[model samples]
Target: MRFPFFSRPAPAAVQPPVADGGTLLETTGLTKSYAGADGELPVLSGIDLTVRAGEIVALLGRSGSGKSTLLRCLAGLLPPSSGTVRYRGTPLTGANPGTALVFQTFALLPWLTVRQNVELGLEARGVPPRERARAADQAIDLIGLAGFENAYPKELSGGMRQRVGFARALVVEPDVLMMDEPFSALDVLTAENLRGELMELWDSGQFPTRAVVLVTHNIEEAVLMADRIVVLGSRPYGTIRETVEVDLERPRDRDSADFDELVDRVYRIMTGRPKDGRPAARPDAERTDPDRPDQDRTERRTLATTPLPSASVDGLSGLAEMIAHRDGRCDLADLADELGLDIDDMLPQVDALDLLGFAEIHGDDLLLTGDGTAFAHADVQDSRALFAGAALDVPLVRLIANSLSGAPGAAVRAGFFRDLLAHHYTSEQIDRQLETATDWGRYAGLFGYDAGRREYRLEEPETGR
Candidate 1:
């Protein structure tokens, strides 16, 4: 698996992979929160994780699942509100010296040449200028950026800039290499090429770092690269939902049955389907009887406890139609592939359908309810009517409708809801919640938002009710 480009002699600082297994990074009861406008907003909770030597651990989850937060915690970029993050068994007081982070955006200085950027870490460590140059040259050559060392970041392609990022991190020779969606910003082909090359380097036992931690939303990418995958859940704040071990050999075949099976298993876990065929677990306080009526279930939910997924009525309805076309049930992973979407891209829509009682996840399959099938087969106006009824079953949409009903001129300021949501969500989360609520409310003909006035007005003669 070794590539000729990475066959250069290792510098004195670039150590070979150690066979003696050791814990590189460990976190126990690590909880992170931010102070919101009204109160504290929890991001990650009770995470007990460990990254061992000679392994690549992928933290996998959709956006808002605290994948990046957990990565930052491991890198000691952000302090946890409680618990400990330890590097090689020592608790971190500040940045973990044993780790180096590569950002998704390729955070390179435009003014610095590629060699200089790669030398930055060495410079900070007070390495002699000549030694720094030598180390930087070795790293640059190892990453296939030898000729481009004199080029500034502005003159490089996205992939080249990212290579420079890798060289910069490798030059420091940190014990643990931390990457936050580093390949996500590159074009698909380029990302694949770069990812393959890096994996080759690792397989060849020449990678500078002892362990790697990667944060990603792409399931296939995680399966392709990680020795272990840690899946994070977003509901009721972030927590480690499941950890899966990849038993397949390296330079893995994506088309192999084993790989496909593993991907499906991860999908089921991510979508809250238990492997034992039982219903997925929910927070005790938020769980409701499945036999309960729609209104009763909706009544049990609140905006704070049940945040809306950022799914549009159109997008979810389209998914419903596709599922109906498959006779009301389909494998979620197959559906994602058919739609040319990553599983994470479709999760919000799946969540929306589940939230509105339009669909249910059974094992790895998405099965449309009787209501979902009908809505999918209905004509445009009829579908809208069906969707309106279903949207009303969501708490946020219900709240907005009720508020507009009780307000003067059948209108209420959007800020009123935003302020209420602030107590439970960060400003960014608040915006997303309101955005989803607004989309559902408008599609349901229950409310309309005036951007100019920031008001939600009740629709005339609401049809859903």
Candidate 2:
């Protein structure tokens, strides 16, 4: 439940025993790909995983890391291009009665009341009306929505709607419950309450599900809920980087030293830094010189393989000022609490600042450099100039800017940039990257984009002003 920095790691439980049963779901040689203009774009590759009854497995990775893809495969919502997904020794074909999926959107029908929505699955199977109604009523009560069973989805709060989602999944008596960022959309207090309630249900053996597969971006949530945490990498395909078991007892202590160390260890793994204070090999094919610190920072700054910029300059500056105001350096966990941000929201801001050399991440704390401090206090024009300089140095930005400046009227078709980026990323990824570039360009007064003309043009001195 805490996002403390992990530094010292304790030994995990070796061969932790499954409380109830044997392997409930397993995947072998799991691979998934989408059809691209050139060929197939692989998302997952050779992922071998197993889940036993009574175990909770959390798949943790960045947003575009294919965590959701893997979960979809396991739930039989989407078929993998290649590989096998077996449920209790049977090859899973499509939606199975033994499996249920809880979505982050709380995918409920607004026209249906809570009880009716909960019983939708049973109705699909043509269960007797009386039997289905009884099961739905029981499930509603189980999830603490007993009195609200007659309320329509539109009448309930976000958390209540999500609880209805849980009840719907549970009503089916599924053997495996697959959750894709189930708590991400709820308020903090509500999410924590739901997490606690779910854990209690699992502990008491009161739920229909035997095992849970959770896909999340929150390392703290993973540590708190999972028996095993699987770290995934993003590149040609999503691959398993490492698997760690949580040895701590249930009802985990957020302030425990062991918890902090484990969280730190996961962070290091995610960032490609080893716990022994050594640089680990990046999962991508392009390798960087571990000896050159500048190269590492350079790699992050470029848009080569990074996701769309999720944080704006204003957001970054606000965080920098907060860091300077707090203590020149602040613990990331404490900062998240102060800023009212989840780990998912906080990471992108941290990464943006770090990539720009304005701030640095060390263990669990963030430190602002002298330039960063000055920028935090600078006027709007000064900040834009500073950001513009940094933006021009990025490889993709530099290439685009150079190409545009060389042309007549300092203009180039938007497709020119997309074509250039497609060589390095898929079409889908290229779209996200281009959108991010546009944001950065506008912020720094580096360029102007014409959506109707489908072109990018160099900005004059007074263009934005």
Candidate 3:
């Protein structure tokens, strides 16, 4: 699977640089389904994630449950069937300079020493030799692999080898660091020690990752480490069953009655009865909260589901058909002209829809396929930003599924995120008649327009009437 695979191309104005820190990584409608001998295998579905700077999020699930797959998707190691993985506001492709992954197998080269292994990624990306070397050395020391810098992989212990793996990924100074069951190969004692050390290092900011995602099946480890623990359902494939957050006081004691109760709570959630709607049961504080372990009935309600946005059916076909059927024989140039887009900026979108079986890209002109045409005919209510993010033709359909719940039937909002784009689009540009461009600024979610109201919505209500 490839990275930067968006169900649709993102708005150009949404490009995010390394400096943005508040909200680091977010995934939308992430689903990875594969064709198999029997039938389609759904690995993970509708995985929406958010990782902020300086936070540690743990992915926990039984083996074969696609926790690893989710991590890979997050890392751009795998492409999602229907969704978007955005780093800051931009799409994630391959291994970005800001992100890297450590595999469960510790994919280290036997011929390379610890230091050399760490330098591989940097060198591959064309970093100068001197700087790469310095980074590798620093990473090695941070992971306590300092003395093993010159040691070959064969000479190192399993734990040391994993450390080398961590170092290789860390040298890049990524904004997001992902480890897929990285310590499963080592013995419990070694794994425990390494986990503690890693946590200590991260706490001290010895490693440069803005956020870290660790995948593990060990409930205790996840409870001890993560700010949030995501447990995916077992699968040929399935969606996340539960995500238990640990807002416990630090230095968690496994032997304490509180820890034991929290563990049981998670176990029950995974193995016990399926509760209500999507995010599942409400756990009692005695069962889940690490901080208030002794308080059996804490104030917080567990398993609060985020409200799903109304399904915005901004059918590309609807737009295409509006033009094609209304005008007859729609051509790319004609469509572009109506939507206010240039041929160049619109190419990727046509390619994406074609890839998704949504449209057909014929030689010179494009036409909506049956499914595409169907989508077009259906009315949708989406994040007003759909208009802001898409080529004049296609809509930011995901936002519709995420933000539209209020309107009755056939609710569609325009300009939902127009104001958010204000920072990115110049006054002249916003006034420039939104064609190919859209402001993909931070917190753009707050700037969409309610389709019914036809007014741009602001996070903070605009003062003037």
Candidate 4:
């Protein structure tokens, strides 16, 4: 599943220097926090990043990693709780006229035509109507929206609307373009096309925007588009974990060795796994599998306290099938692009397979276990039995089942489980974990949850009786 159109001849070297240019935008000890009932909830902490002129930097992190918050602070849309954001050595107190933002939702005015929408920014800057119209027209031509200038946003497709978004940003002729998941909302083909187009535009040096800051959850997008990729850790203190340089030539081959290696490197950093490919101890591995309870439990609690990966059973099965199809192995980046999934969408399923011991995440490849291959080829009943056995072996699921089975009424209050989970997870994380637990329990036929009654009851065992 590789596209030749996405590949180009490798250049001698495409890597930018450690310091590419004079910093166009710089953050010094930037921190953001909000007042909360429990205490102050910190979103970002002591973070620093720089975007130089003519560079594209991607801020990559998980859902709550404050990537968007950092983008806002950089664009002067949000005030930081502390620290300083400077533009060319000048303090940025508010929205900078030299910076423009493009949003994920295509924030175009409903009443405005494409041209009008593009002109809106210029109007706000007190540009005369004639000048605004000319700039908007030029931007429309630049983004390949020349023919649709008079069309309303509602009449445009998702990709077209986003192009309008790009045009609107470009019409302002900003020095810095801040993009918040600009291509995420589009279909796979559209996204790839837009990404390629953007690279072409940047390479041609026709656009006035001198720098770009992209906020995204997609590792492949970052690798493809960024000069430097900054990975942010989990919240409520999303700090910089590491920064990676993508030195590959443009039109990067997703299947190329170097590209895949870079993708795997980012994955390891995101999952806190070693690049040496030694397996990280999965959450239920120690307790459910019971190999080393003390160390495993400690590690489990630490990971569970963070936001749970949102993986679906279907996603897991699909990924497993892909790996099995590839002879029990598949490159993470290639598989992700083949399935039209972003890294954010793909990693969770891989993580779920790892957690259940069905697959091993070795560097950038997903290798199915014997059980995983069996599960992939198994009949319905056999598959259910296999899953049931695995689910009941998970420590949290086992704990819930034991609580219900041991109770006098053969049921336990949901609050009890919630409290138990709360001891290890934040409130938001607890909610996600609870949802995950419920789904796994249901699939395994190990427990039945009564949402209205807020209780869990033991179910008839499905296998290994």
Candidate 5:
């Protein structure tokens, strides 16, 4: 049977394009940074991107990968620190007149009714009140909010409120629509339903925008909706690591072999494995020998270059144990499915395992190293010892332990490290680094953290030692 959206006819005013249209937006050498305590803190660098009239593009990445930042740049909401953002071949001076944004948080005026809220864009453009009302009604009806036009945002459900957001963006009829995690705030079923309906609208030529650019961290969501998926990499700074074209027909099946294979491929790319099953080079590495395993590249790491993933000892160890139970290897995608998690949710733990030399990713599969297998099988005391050695090898953890050891009275305020980290990271990122370090340090018995005092104290030696 054909997909529901596929069977529907286009609205009278809208017609399916005979062919793909021209470029709507483009970015060249786009780099962005913020001034920090030490120097410039780079978020994105050397980014060259484009969005065309007939395609839906997904910018996919992890938390620090700057997907939203890129979206803002494209929308002309945030100017690039260097390079250029152009709309229809003209360099943007301010907000792009051709684009409208849908935010993650609904961003509705609680005091305004649905029709009034949707009319905000039209009013700003100096559209007459009567014309604004007509456009808002059409948009509200098209998005399935026909009867709720007079209701305030508070009177509607979460899904309904978001429908207002979509209506508001659509009413403007911008050349490009920008969405930043628009469905992520909704429940799973709600998100799925909304996604299906939106795609149906696009397929049926009823969508108001000429093209779409979506910012998301969900791998499956990108595969299911985007005509092209641009994967961003975060390590030192954000860059477009790869772009995969989705050649599958519409109404993709999650259970189909081709769909599953594409998901697996994207999973591998996000985890540092290339399309050919080879490990990608570390962003911070200066290795002269290209044949060296990725683990060896960590020898040159520093706190700024290889900040710790926000993973706890218990969490990472549990992941290790799971892999050991699966005969020391498991497909990462399958493991995420079995655990009922999005693969992005499992990344921190998987990254922790790789960072600590406990595991390695070979294409789509996660393979435990010799140390990982031993640690998984070891008793508590032995596991602690193994973890201590591993943690010490990590730059940030080792720095904290050594800093406390050499301080007066074997203690130092956490603010000292925070200041050092501020040179490289934002306030939020610094907190995550410290929290992860604290967890790992305490677990290894390398140091102790006094939460009330905001201090790191060295662990005393055993009597015999």
Candidate 6:
């Protein structure tokens, strides 16, 4: 199902759909190689893929997979070591016309303001100044960055920075929009909001992309937004599975037996393991009540963290502004959207880290304890390290991974990632990427992980214990 790109497009009539299955972009047995310490490291080999006029396909795999290489080949960023890529029936040797990508990093020019960044795409295409301004305006408004055009990259929050990346892509009105974990750097709430807006624009025909090819590790995200899921096999790189025509239904029922069934299958295939050992899904609020589990479908937690009191207060947010802006905390709205919480949500997660002697929440200001701040700065994705010592006694990474993976459209609170480590993952992996989410939060942290004894023990830690 192709979600239309422009719900409320410009007054101009939409163009007719590009013919289906006629090679909007086609790659035959594509392969890529790079020079490594050992020399001649093969990245992608004999890869075959076809994207139609309006297709959104997900390339799913673990870290070290060749998804990035393939994306670069298609976008013409890197020349393929072997095989061929064809766009609109013509072979593509390099960055072809009419394609744009939004990367995990904003990669905006540090010196350029948001307005200049959005305008760069058009300027590259040689669009005249008058037309460039018009297109930039539309793209900025499209991504909700109307008044922010003049802000430099350093002045914007991570989420806003990402918008600049996206707006640059949209301002050109490319034929295909390719993104590599585009929201991976953002907070859950911000990612959801951006995704919601993108879906609305695409479906409404306001942003009619000819095709969109997104690459991500989050299986639930792939399932939710993609029309097809392409699973890549281990090592030496290539496609092992292409399961098209997924039938989970729209606004997906994650708790439904059917959704789990598909998720289970995909999880097994992607992990090189069978479906038998994976855990169930639950968030912190649900874990609080053992007898009464949180049910899905009716009212899910609206945000990822708890709300603050009725009146505005200082130190409600994190040390974020306290260090940069020189305040313990800031207004909820001043909080970074990419950081995922307003002042209301940030304080609790900060406190969660505090209770385990990981952090301190004083006057609503998030001050990471000595060790907490160290862990916050470390590389925490190592699976073994995630479970180290007493940080997590159970399968906490699996808990968080499953919660995010299974929840799909819903926001997995920031605390879900932090507290899960209280019970699961070796201290190593958690310290690498699982525990420190501010970096790769979008892809890895959202769907927490677990090895076995896989179950949802999602509970808020006993306060001040």
Worst 10 residues of 6 by lDDT: 304-313
For model 3, residues 137-191, the per-residue Cα lDDT tens digits are 8778777887777999999889988988888877766778888778778887898
Q: How many steric clashes does model 6 contain?
A: 57
Which rank order by lDDT, best down to worst? 5, 1, 2, 4, 3, 6
Q: What is the lDDT of candidate 2?
A: 0.77
TM-score of candidate 6 relative to the true fold: 0.56
Each prediction's total of clashing residue pairs, residues at least 3 apart in sequence or on different chains, is 0, 1, 20, 0, 0, 57
lDDT of 1 at 160: 96
lDDT of 6 by residue, 73-178 (tens): 9988888887899877778876866578999998999998888888886676566767777777777877899998788999988889998898888766677889
Candidate 3 runs further than 4 Å off: 1-21, 37-39, 274-465
Candidate 6: lDDT of 351? 31
What overall lDDT, based on C-alpha atoms, would model 4 receive against the true structure? Answer: 0.76
Best by lDDT: 5
Which digits, one per residue and each the tens of the lDDT, describe model 5 over residues 278-363?
66655624654422445554477788788889888889999999999999999988888789676457999999998888887777
User: What are the Cα lDDT values of the candidates?
Assistant: 0.84, 0.77, 0.58, 0.76, 0.85, 0.56
- Residue 463's C-alpha lDDT in candidate 2? 77
* Cα shift from native, residue 54, model 1 (Å): 0.7
Residue clash pairs of candidate 4:
none
Order of all candidates by TM-score, from best down to worst? 1, 5, 2, 4, 6, 3
By summed lDDT, the worst window of 10 consecutive residues in model 5 runs over: 1-10
Q: Candidate 2 residues 1-465, lDDT tens each?
A: 111111221111122333565987889999998876457778889999998888899999876678999998888889988999987777888855467899999999999999999989878766677778888888888899999989998999999999999999887766778999999999889999999999998888786677899999888899999999998877545899889899999889989999988887787666555565344444432533212234444455455565554677677888888888876688776666556665557877887776666776665667776667767877888888877866765666666778875443588898887876665567777776677678778888778888999888877656753
